[model samples]
Target: MSQIPLEHILLLSAVLFCLGLLAVITKRHAVVVLMGVELIFNAANLNLVAFSRYDPSLLQGQLFSLFVIVVAAAEAAVALAIVLRVYQHFKTANLNEIATIDK
Candidate 1:
């Protein structure tokens, strides 16, 4: 079986990153923003794995990707906890309203 080209993988990663960024910027819900951040992390992971395929010996890219995954998981847990607390305090998950309340 022929391997997929790196360029195609990178292109897909770029698309994922852009879509994630758009969601993070345009969506109002805290959960949606978290999902967007996940998408961005996934895009980076994809790129890392794709590049790792080229030099199988070192495995640096794959290792780094694993580290990133771990960090992302921790980040998600902490962020969700913060969001939950914010929701409890504010009674709403809309980021705009949250920001307004801060002032």
Candidate 2:
């Protein structure tokens, strides 16, 4: 049985990153945008893990990925808190409807 190539993982991560970019650009819902951000973060993490698996000399990629995961978790928490506050103030989570405070 043949093992899968690391290039395949990189390609998949690229596709996911593109899809997340599209979602962030096209979606108007706050939660959907958040999901897109998470997807992008995961794609980057996937790339890090893939590189770590393929390169024996670098354990740093995997360690960096762990740090990214932790940061992503904190980002999610803060983002969700902000989203909830926006929902409470606006009564909806649609990004299009949420006006800038200064505007």
Candidate 3:
């Protein structure tokens, strides 16, 4: 069986990172921004897995990736909760509108 190239894997990771950055920068909705952050995390995870494939130990990369996944899940939950509260308090999820918190 032919194995995939490391360069290709890194390229995919780069693409994912860029897309996530674009989403975070261009989107105004809090949920969309959260999704973007998740994308970035996924990209990092992919890189970790890919690099782990080349390592002799083989376990370190996968273990780190698993840890990252757990942290990301927790972060997403807390972030969504915060977003929900913000929406409840402000009646809008747009980040720009939420900036005017003095009202």
Question: How accurate locally is residue 86 in candidate 3, as Cα lDDT from 0 to 100?
Answer: 94
How do these models rank on lDDT, best leading? 1, 3, 2
Q: What tens-digit string does per-residue lDDT give for candidate 1 at 22-102?
A: 999999999999999999999999999999999889899999999999999999999999999999999999999999997
lDDT of each: 0.96, 0.91, 0.95
The estimated TM-scores of all candidates read 0.95, 0.91, 0.95
Candidate 3 Cα outliers beyond 4 Å, as residue runs: 101-103
- Measured with C-alpha atoms, the lDDT of residue 44 in candidate 3 is 97
lDDT winner, 1 or 3: 1
Q: Highest lDDT: which candidate? A: 1
Of 2 and 3, the candidate ranking higher by lDDT: 3
Q: CA lDDT of 74 in candidate 1?
A: 100
* Cα misplacement distance, residue 8 of candidate 1 (Å): 1.0
lDDT string for model 2 (31-55, tens) is 8998999999999999998888878
